[model samples]
Target: MIDQLSLTNFKAFRSADIPLAPVTLLTGLNSSGKSSVLQAFVLLRQSYDSSTLFSSGGGLLLNGELVELGTGLDVLHEDVVHTPGLPTPLISIGLRTSEGQNFNWSALYAAEQDVLTLHSASDAQRTKSVFDRRRFQYLKADRIAPATSYPKSHHQAIGLGFLGASGEHTVNYLRHHARRPLTSKPLRHPKAQTNNFLDHVVAWMQELCPGVNLEATEIPGIDAVRLSYGFDGTAGLTSSARRRPTNVGFGLTYALPIVVACLSAGPGSLILLENPEAHLHPRGQSRMATLMAAAAAAGAQLIVETHSDHVLNGLRLAVKNGAMSATDTAVHYFRRRGLQAEIVTPRIHEDGSLSDWPEGFFDEWENSLEQLLD
Candidate 1:
């Protein structure tokens, strides 16, 4: 797993070394650089997949599968530093693995060009395994909404085990791997009917909405899959009746990819999630955090970008519930300072309390309560 990420002259950061943990949470105000951090990894992964990362062309592909960072000027830090003799301010992205291997890829800036040329770098091949398609998943915030049909991509869903940045391939992936036994202890839901992946996914989704069950089925000849929800007992919808995802709540479809991603994790897997609590209720948001904690306990590393305090409390509750260790978690509160972004990390204690609570760090509720009392 990557132990730390270093950004130099990159967007929203002139220089910063961010420490990562088994389960890292990035929380802060809008555009405070949380997404930028995840984009850095996706940029490398996509560039590597497209044969642009270290090819003879040997450059960073700004527009690719996972991210489209645009021209150098768009990504370059506004207050970029100028070293003594370099022609252009180099933007660098590097990572140090827990195994102690280091790889830094620096590129010289070009105003109009989308791809940036690498100026200097260490041996990048030694760390190539970190970007393996099977071991990584980056889910962006604009996830799939409630829809009757979802696209099916055999190569991405089955071959690469990717759910897409928008999690568009989730239903197909879930359908293809439904019967696979989930061997990871921490990830296995206790209430699951069996050890199957689909059961575990349904069990976890029940936390968001009790008695809610799902079925992902192939849609005839076309490259598409259909997702339907079935509520248990004689309620609004009968257990025997199948309802399209379009008729169900948006939260279910939006949260499906995250649930599947967490349940599908294996040892050494890396998941970068953006707004995992999107469309979820407060209770369900907290439940999502615990599910992520379970993923970490199962040996996957997760770097989550969220704005929900419920997610934070849920992670805390996970640690308190012994799902994971406090040492395995890291919480970063990002805030914009002038023209650049900065991070303030708070230490999570074993008892689920934080060592420090900086201003504006998940304190909105307390602030509001105080105002109401006044």
Candidate 2:
């Protein structure tokens, strides 16, 4: 699990060190640097797993160039100069495990020289060190390609593969997992919950979309497995409603990856998500938040960027319901100025309420009042 992340000359941040928790929520106004935080993780994951990061054409584009590293901080555009005399841009990330193990890595760019360098605590003492940017996996929202029909041979093999940031392959991932049965005794979290991770996920999804039953099936001629969600209906209902994956709504399709990722993630895996609440109604968004908190409680660390208060409230409800401990979650708010962004930590209460509601924190009523008064 990641415990800290520090950014220097990375996008809207000149220098900032942000702490993390099992489940971390990033919320802010438009252009307030919420996306930058998610982008930083994508870049870090690309440094480790380039193939997955660049699988889709919509992946990261630095200054219109597809260069992976040492491409400079121009990736994060700014209108003002920071530190007047600084010569390079830097981005560093720190990760810690439950056992207190720590890993520190950084990337540096010199715009004038058009050179970039990757650094890490493992090589801090050396003058020059070789950097290998293939140790992590990344997914970005824009890079997610919808699953589509193609030649049966074109189907990708499944194992421990990557899911894009937008959760494009969520349905596929869940379908793959549903076919495999427990090889060992069902794994349980510290809290001794009766259901395993995958069971809990399916339960939550059922709660969100009632009358739907998910299962995995193998095509007669195709080697690939497919996930199907059957809708409980009368025999006279349309064929689509009686089918599997085809019968489910798009919201369930979009939410599948998040559920699969959390259930499949191991102790050390790092999951980065941007607005996991997209495309869902307020109730569904809240349910998604609860699932995320449950994932964190089960031991997978999550870093999420969201603007929905419904998602936030859902997490609080999870805490209040004892699904997750308050100490295991944290909320960070970002506010952008001309060139820099400010990060604030909000206090979460036992009742799952926020201690301080910042100005404009989902204040649509205030905007309406101003219009009425004027």
Candidate 3:
């Protein structure tokens, strides 16, 4: 899991070192640098997979252009309109094992010099790398930009460790993995729970459209597997009712990726998500948060960027209900001061309660009172 992330010359962050826990929640106002934290991780992962620093052109691109990596001191401000010459916009991430082994990696770009560099902790050497950086999966709100292909399009097989950000191929991935036994490896889920997992996914959809069941079957002429949601009437149904993903409500499609991704992620895998609660009802959002908490408990590291109070409350409830440990969770709030942003970590108690409530921290009452006072 990521133990610490230090940003220098990255967007909104000049120089900041934030500690990370197993399950970290990043909450803040829009553009307060919350998303940048997730972006930093995505970039780090991309660095590992890329052959050159700016080659792959994946998540690192912002607004259809490469992200400018400024010098470290450039982001720091001495006072209004007075800033020191910045250092290279270098980003460093510190990772530690449960046994306390630490690994640090850094990346930067020099526009004037037209060069990008990547450095690893153990290796004293710095080298220019390509865009095809390391393999790090991310689920952002605007997952892949308009020009990029679907995340899974590059993969030949359906379930070989490929999960798209939009989770487009989620159902297909699940179906493909479910059919084959992993080679010489014990199945992770018990038969009963595996069945329950499928049932739960379909059942959640059924709430929106009753009597629905998801089935994975090969098309008559195609080699690809497809998922179809079937609906039936009461007992002794008259006709078979089924629909493609396009026909069902988007919520079903949106929630599918989150559920499948959580179930599929193993230890040491990093799952970065932006607003998993999007398109979900309050109840469904709460349930989704619980699912994520469970994944974290099972050793998958999750960093979620969310704007949902329901999601936060659900995580707290999960901790209270023994679904997650308080120690495994960290809630960081991003607050902006002029051009710089500050991160505040909230303390979660043993009983899943918050120790401090910062101003404007999901408090609707403040808005209500302001309106009245105004």
For each candidate, C-alpha RMSD in Å? 1.1, 6.3, 6.1
Q: Against the hidden reference, what TM-scores do the models get? A: 0.98, 0.75, 0.75
User: Total clashes, candidate 1?
Assistant: 0
Error in Å for residue 25 of model 3: 0.8
lDDT of 1 by residue, 1-374 (tens): 88999999999898999999999999999989998899888888877888777776577888977788999889999999876699889989999999998889988899898888888766667766877779888899999989879999999999989999999999999999999999999888889999999999999999999999989999999989999989986376787799888888789999999999998888899999999999999999999999999999888999999999999999999998888999999999999999889899998898999999999998988999999999
Pairs clashing within candidate 2: 47-133, 48-134, 48-135, 48-136, 170-257, 228-245, 229-244, 229-245
lDDT per residue for candidate 3 within 117-204, as digits (tens), equals 5532333232222111222346767432211112233352252455665565554566656544322111133322234446545544
Candidate 2: regions farther than 4 A off: 50-73, 76-91, 94-102, 110-115, 119-157, 165-172, 179-201, 220-225, 234-248, 369-374
| CA error at residue 96 for candidate 3, angstroms | 4.2
The lDDT of model 3 is 0.60
In TM-score terms, candidate 3 sits at 0.75
State the number of backbone clashes in model 2: 8
Reference-based TM-score, model 2: 0.75
* Global local distance difference test of model 2: 0.59
Best by TM-score: 1
Which of the numbered candidates is closest to the native, going by highest lDDT? 1
Clashes of 3: 22
